[model samples]
Target: MTHYRSFVALGDSFTEGLNDPAADDRGGAPDRFRGWADRVAERLAALDPEFRYANLAVRGKLIDQIVAEQVPLAVGMRPDLVSFCAGGNDLLRPGSDPDRMAKKLAGAVRDLRATGAEVLLFTGVDPRDTPIMRRARGTFAIFYLHVRSIADLYGCRLVDQWSMQGLRDWRAWSDDRLHMNEEGHRMVAAKVCDVLGVPTEDDWRMSWPPRERVDPRVKRREDVQWVRSHLGPWVVRRLRGRSSGDDLDPKRPDLKPFG
Candidate 1:
């Protein structure tokens, strides 16, 4: 198997491991989403004691921002491998241009690959299981294909999250219906490792037991609650032209040795 002694990940919340809180996150400046990148790092470190990993992902960054900021730092680090996940937040907005974003991302991939490092890119997941996410599925699918085109053009090994069968269950999502929970992140990590040809333990395809039936009225009530807690706040943020990553720096900014 090919060995990657150093790894660096960059992108938004999904790459940052959102909603998947760390087990022993000491009180810190910003929240930690112990995402799939960290898990993959751990596995890599276990195989090679000299392994080092860095994740330069922040929450709510657009493709242009990620390209402008994270790409340079990642290229400078010169890691043997780089994983990038971006452009989802842009698609989440109404009428966000997919071609321009795909071009920006392709440029980043081109630059990163010029450093002679292996590049890994991911596609947007199929969120049709979530009612709100389903509404934008058509638009998001176009974005997904744009990414696919970039991956193909750049010769990047793509992690097709949209094709993941395990994500069909609603339980794979967090309370916000946007980010994935711990289990979903784990499955993603496994999928990444599978793509990278790294060994893993658990079966990511394992789904939860059947859910009990819920009354239509109860489901409607939960939908209202979801709006109050998650959707409403997101809309407010969008309206204000603010991002969750605003005023926040990447959690693991430096590329260094890992545990």
Candidate 2:
């Protein structure tokens, strides 16, 4: 298997690892966030002492913003491995065209590929059963197909999130119903390792233990609370043309050795 000496990840909140705060056991700073990319980097670092990684992802970035802000830096870093996951934020907007977004992403991928780095891409997870997101399942699928096509055309590695049945469970997601929780990030890391031919103890497809079903009344109350706490503010931001990441920067900007 090819041993990548360096890896750089580019995209928005998912790549930035929102909602999944860094744990003490992971040796990450308590104030910082640690997502699946960080988890993947840890495993990769174990394979080689000199392995370096950088994450140029921020929260609330649209596809265009990512292409403009993150892609160029990733190219300059010249890492042997690259992961790109964008366009989900755009898909959330009304009248967003998946085809156009795909074209933009394809151009970025083309440039990344020109650098001879092994590019990795991800499909948005299945959102059919997800609240609010379920409304845009059709759009998400279109974009996912485009991503698959790009991966095939460019010979990049793919993490097919749509096929990961394990993520379909509510336990895999955070209370916001947008980003994944700690368990969700862990599973994603395992999946990435599997794709990169890295040996890992965790299995992305591992089944969850049996649990009692939630009462329908309690579920209804939670839904109302979610709308008030999460969905309401998100809609307001869209109206005002703002983002959650407006003041945020990438947690790990430099391509340096990872522990």
Candidate 3:
């Protein structure tokens, strides 16, 4: 069996467990403070009494920020096992540059690999089928594919989080219609355990619930309105010689793409 003395997780909100409702109820409150990475750590501890784990994920963090902050912290930990779940926020807005995102992801992988840690990279689910969530899914797929290719290039293990349970079944998500709920968190924890060769209880099995479908026309109108409110001015300004890069300094922490 594969042996890892310590585990570390690095990435963004999905990695941090943003939408899990159960996190508030749990004594440790990982969902609010921890994330999927912390949940995976909890599962690992349950499987092996001796396993040690730490989560370094932060909410709303992009690949570049992770590399600059979390990557060094993870390297310092000298963990044997490491997993990363990111790229969701990168897909939130339409016309966000995929090539730039991919480049930043590649840097993150390379930096982590330099620490000599065995890394597991997770690709997020495609949200295309969801009426209001469709546009971002296309961009998500592109980002995921590129990250997978980067993992292959770096000889890292790739976890197919997008294909895991709860993605196809919308009921796994929370009432907000974006984040995953308690059941969703459990499913994610189970999948990470499987990838790490950790044993889990039978109760860990996930069930897909019926999804609510919305009218495509309504979703389209909503998308148009969202874009007009968020990206319209930015696009117009870019066309008029005010570039996005210029308007929002890359170094500014609050300059992320608004959904």
Minimal lDDT window, size 10, model 2: 23-32
Model 2 agreement with the true structure over 86-135: per-residue lDDT tens digits: 98899888999999999999999999999999999999898999877789
lDDT per model vs. reference: 0.87, 0.93, 0.66
Which portions of model 2 show Cα errors greater than 4 Å? 23-30
lDDT of 1 by residue, 1-259 (tens): 7799999999999999998888555665345568899999999999998888989999999888889899999999999999999877888888888777777888899999999999999987887777666788877888789888888888888899988888777788799988988888999999999989999996676768989999999999999999999999999999999998899988788877785
- Tens digits of per-residue lDDT, candidate 3, 117-216, equal 8889878766865555586666778888987898899988887876765556756666445567666777777777777677666233466555578899
Q: Which residue segments of model 1 deviate by more than 4 Å? A: 25-31
Ranking by lDDT: 2, 1, 3
Q: All candidates' TM-scores? A: 0.95, 0.96, 0.72
In model 3, what are the clashing residue pairs, if there are any?
16-35, 17-35
- What number of clashing residue pairs does each candidate have, in the order they appear? 0, 0, 2
Report the Cα lDDT for residue 48, model 1.
91
